[model samples]
Target: MAEPTERDPLIQKPTVFTDADSASRGEPATKQRLGPLEISASNRRGILAGIWLGTFLGVLTLVPTMMPSISSEFQKFHLASWLGTAYLLATCTFTPLYGRLSNVMGRRGANHTAIAFTAIGTVMCGLSRNMESLIAARFIAGIGGGGLFTTATIIVSDMYTLRNRGLVHGVASCFNGLGMGLGGPFGGLITDLLGWRAAFLLQIPLFVFALILIQYNIRYVTPGKSKGTMEMLKRIDYLGSLTLLVALGSPLFFLSARYNESLPWSEARVITPLILAIVFILGFLGVELFLAKEPVLAPGMLQQKVPVLVGASNFLVGACNFSVTYFYPMWFQVVMLQSASTAGMHLMPNSVSMSIGSLFAGWMMHSTGRYKRINLIFGIFPFIGTTLISRLREDSGPIHSWLSIIPLGFGNAVALHTMLIALLAHLPESHMAVGTGFAQLFRGIGQVLGVAISSAIFQSRLDAELRKRFHVPDAENLIRQIRRNSNYIRELPSEQQAYARDSYALALKTVYIFAACLTISAYLVRLPIPDQDLDKAHARQRAQAEARRNSTAEVATTNAVASTSTGSGLPTPEYPARSPTETETEPEEPAA
Candidate 1:
């Protein structure tokens, strides 16, 4: 066979071998230190393990396997969904601040803060005596959970170059997939054995381990000259952050009230929050665009084509992927009459497929330094998976149930990995933290929004179906019980049980259809993102930095020569100079 032609210059570049080749020879991943520690590449394993453990903790909370049991205990099934929503709402709201916080507090301090919050909140969740208190505790946990993953991403970026980031990010994603895949089963098993409260309590020891790992393995480095604590505090955009909370929180409140609780649209409690949400959204934009000195969400980043598209894609995919995570298991338990543990186990295939997809995308980008084709191709996976899912019936076999969700998980993982690479490729080094924050913020919003919207749709459809099927005077009370509690279906008569299962199946079908639409929209939105070569972009950044340094050095030399020759008749020594061609102005890099 003929030798394959090399179309890209990066494929032939020898320097591309630096990290991988050194690692193969058992050298440090990079000469750079992580925090104050000068650990070798082998020690990076511990850092990754710690980071993934924290991620596993965060994702473990997302599954809520004992939600049905918790709701039944509280006798407030309608409020049960809030346990998850509250966590997600807090996660999305606080996420943007972590990016900036890492700069002021240093990565170590920020990471430590996140772990502390998660630990405190998890404990409170276990101790809660009421539904309201439990939701509040979850909100606190979410505040900490949001930072763990984002800080981990920032730490990895510091360690790896753009060329190597793909592989590293991919591996990181495998941990994410591991957490996501295992979270369901783990939570289900824990719930079955010790009850839901134990699930929260059991995560505490792991959180402490993660905290110790971060302390020993990761250190915070100030970006520039050290500033006073007051000065650093000043840099945080208090106004923008607060405004963002209102902007995001209000709409979620409105959704939960209007749909989840079945409140009328014209009710003051519902309409007022919706209006406030809209108003704050506008005000938040104003603050970011013109008011804050260092805006929480930079206006300049969103002005560009790549970040905008990537953010939107993240949002859509988050909606679809998270919706599946939260609701798919309910299908097994409610419709197919499976136990919580078995339902959780059924999620394993989707999670495994997601890990495979994430690894594949990461390796591809790392080896090839290209992501455009991968981005475009993976968008279709979720759409196909969700479409198949929407058609699921109570009679659907195990093979059909297991196989249907794989594409959504696999495809969603690939799209997320590739889109992240694509966004990072176009951003300047200085903006990486905030730029990444922006993407994560959108995704967090989508996760909450997806679940909230799906919950609303599910509850509404189930209520209508039940009311239509049963005309007895007690029908209203029974429908209310069914809508609020998943476990309630099991207590009904055999005839009623069949009808309730069918109703749940139908409601889930509608929810999946909505999710399918989101996946297809995400697929279409990803089409216009420009495919920048990772190596080439890094090469340009290096070239630009070199040019600036040389220009500064030339200016210094010219000044020194003039000063030395001011009065003395001694001739000035020749200094090397660049030709006109070498001094040509380079094109400005596209803004983040």
Candidate 2:
């Protein structure tokens, strides 16, 4: 057999098999496939990661569809809003923790832990008797769901080199889009047929299946393993974690409480938490940068230009993506007078286009090994889509709404997945998990912010419109009724119904316009991203790592040889050391 070289496809790359080597050995390449699929090992891992990503996102997306059903059953419309808020809050809070934990405990252990939390939370949600209980359960599920998303991305980074990660991320994103797209329709269907509880209960088995697949097939690379439980516990940055929790939790509470309760921003419920959140954010930065030996978010990572810019862009993209995700269904339900199931079906176009966009971006990156230009080009779609969406009226046809969503969905998927690949490409392997986690954290924060801002805009506009249009003494009561139950608007007289629909349509337009501006800002920030060949970068990284290992081995071998010679009573040969000038002169003489 020939000696292996770095350029030899079969030698350096462990994730896939090359046909050239297979032909020489009279065997088939890519023989060790994933289940029944005829693909490489790396591709299989990508598929698994996608399944995990999609499942987590699917379960999270179920809450929006379930809101109406929950309100109808529990008679607490206020608490219904918390279903999504609670989940998002928990997700944002625990994402960083999961990232740090994955670094310490290994990806498999952290992943399994997340799956268990999700399953338990799902069961709790299914069995809950009240809205509060369900909210609490959703919070638990959010923790797990967030972990699944962060770790799944990290696992893809671990399994594939930079060159291949674009496609892998794209594949995973497609599943994410699929899960999100299906979640609404599926939740509504299950809710209508069996009940809303069935929606949560049905997910338990699927979680189990995902858990089993990951346990058996997914490979993990664990970093910072400790010898004992106590040591591991000691390694955790407790203060940093607490500060991060407060920093994230307080702001989320402030926004959610203000919007969900219709309180002024100056109210105690809003201002107190907002102030505390600010304080904790400062504390978090201080502890991470100056105090903690092992920071939850490393200060060094914050300093890196690429990671910082990419993370910021991730935040903006998240805001745009999730704003559309949460609001469009409401538009379909309220403005278009569609049922929850029908609204979900209307969202199918966005989901399908998003999947197509993700796959397209991935293929382009894999083939061209370029993303900056692609990102710049695709980044325009969101602005265009949102601008078009902003023009929607109450009487707009399905074709108009659906067509507008396609660009937003496609633009979001392409930008999001591609930026993730770009992020992983720029960071070192050791920091990949943390970087991915922070990206998710920012995205979650964006989702929470998007919902809060949009909700506030929608509710305030609706209230003003109702007051202006209805000059009766019971107008306030009617507005309250409509706010509490969307069905109330449908029950109103034709003129009132049109007025209410127009109000919602106008509010949505503002939200879409805001999202468009946010998307454009993301495009501007993303311009500074460094475009490098992912394959070449990974190859260099591998070479450096191998060189280090070889140097260490050589040192050990030399030391062992010296020890053996001494033990055997052999004379150690010594040579006179030459000066630097002598060495230089000798080389010059040889050349002469």
Candidate 3:
């Protein structure tokens, strides 16, 4: 926040470059009490923001859950997941855009904007009659709900002090899990008794509650006015945002729809979108380097040692994140032979485990002020478990699958939230939002691509296997045959059923194998980050920052003395008060 003056000293401020797990750090007592806006942040509003964010996510999850219901209502089973995919894409795509917007608009304002978007979208979804109308409404809601999750992290980081950031992040994390944890039951009950449409309507009252809390309990603070719209626009890196969105969303959009379409992956429908996304990303990176003064995703942010290592690792975990979130339900439905609601019920533990992991991570970081040790131990658990799950046969029931998923869920909890703490700890303060936004965006991109790539592998392998043995052109036909006559294939079908089931099994296994590889990759990425020296550089910068602050104060004192020189005929000199950034860093022992 400080600007260098003409005679300012050359002492450098300490710039921490934590990339992933840094958000878990806790804030100090004093700083947590106030902020740049001069509003007391360690108040009820902070908790309100977390609740609103989690509720919106909960509401969004309902869209996914209700999609199948809506599909059955409209007799459009094909469009079921699109209800979710629409929101997921929007949330993942626009989070960075909201981050940049919030940087200009103020954190409190971003919260309001997110709530508005989510509320409106949820209401619209409830009212929609057709697939087209439903998808459009979900898309709008997705935009609003998308930024809520990412910005919530920023709000916690901005509002709370560094030392206490972990606690806030952990507490904040509980809300999302709570929403999902509750949503499965709540949505099911709502849909079962009231109808699927009623599930979307429930979010409206929650939004009203959140809005009332914000207007009264939350302080409304504006951003600095001096930057101006044009300067903000110049820094937005629109090309980069577009590039990132396309690169991420393209794969998802294609894969989800491709199988349903005749041409599928072979058509320009898929190929064209894929190529355009890649081209745009390459172009955006080029523009980011040469043109933008303050690019949205700065080259420095990417090239920084901590970020690069953490980011690569994040990509791996991101794959698991998508797989776990998207396919795990399907696994429960198919493997566990449970209804959709029942599958979600079974998934309750994963959400609980994630919440627990986040809290534990925050507490550990707060107490010990170190992340690598716990992170390393927990991060590997899921990788090992998920790998084991991939080896299980199709007939493997709940017990066999749980052997992998229990640890899969547990290990993921430790790895992701821990990485978040490490990241927040390492990123420079000036670029905190950008760093967080990019982390979220690329993480989303990794997820989209992971699902698409993994899905492609599954579909292709399954298609080949089915066609070779059953003489079916694709897996779809095989599934249709099974659905049409349960025992028809079983009757003639020793070889035929074996081929179809084997292909299906292979496809699922392939997905798991890819996920396991990603976990291993993430594990390796985290390993390098720990041994890599970061603390020493931060220490030097902290010392320099202190010297600069002292020097500035002394200069102001000398100016005051000069002003009192009565013999000199000159007027009293006016010295400017030092800005917050120009002032001394907080007196905390560690930078956090």
Whole-model lDDT for model 3 versus the true structure? 0.60
Candidate 2, residues 427-471, lDDT tens digits: the string is: 655456667776777788777676666666666666676667777
- Top candidate on TM-score is 1
lDDT of 3 by residue, 190-299 (tens): 77678988888866776877766655544432212123334454656667666656766666656655652324567778787767767777877776677655554557
Which should have the higher lDDT, number 1 or number 2?
1
Candidate 2's displacement at residue 115, Å, is 0.9
Per-residue accuracy of model 1 over 1-592 as CA lDDT, tens digit each: 1332344221121111112123223232233323312346766776777877887787763345677778888888888777888888888878877887776666767788888998899999999999999999999999988888888888787667787888888888877887777877888898888888887898889999998998786632322322333455676778987898788778778877887778998899799999999899999989888878777677787779999999999999998887777888889888998888888887788888888998999899988889989877776999999989988887778778889989988899899999988888888765777877889989998988888888888888877787777776788788888888879898999988888888888888889999999999999999999888899988776576557556755664575555435454343323212211111011111223
Of models 1 and 3, which has the larger TM-score? Answer: 1
- Pairwise lDDT winner, candidates 2 and 3: 2
lDDT of 2: 0.69
User: Would you list the C-alpha lDDT of every candidate in the order shown?
Assistant: 0.77, 0.69, 0.60
TM-score of candidate 1 against the unseen true structure: 0.86
Runs of candidate 2 exceeding 4 Å displacement: 1-60, 219-230, 264-267, 547-592
lDDT of 2 at 170: 82
> How many clashes would you count in candidate 2?
0
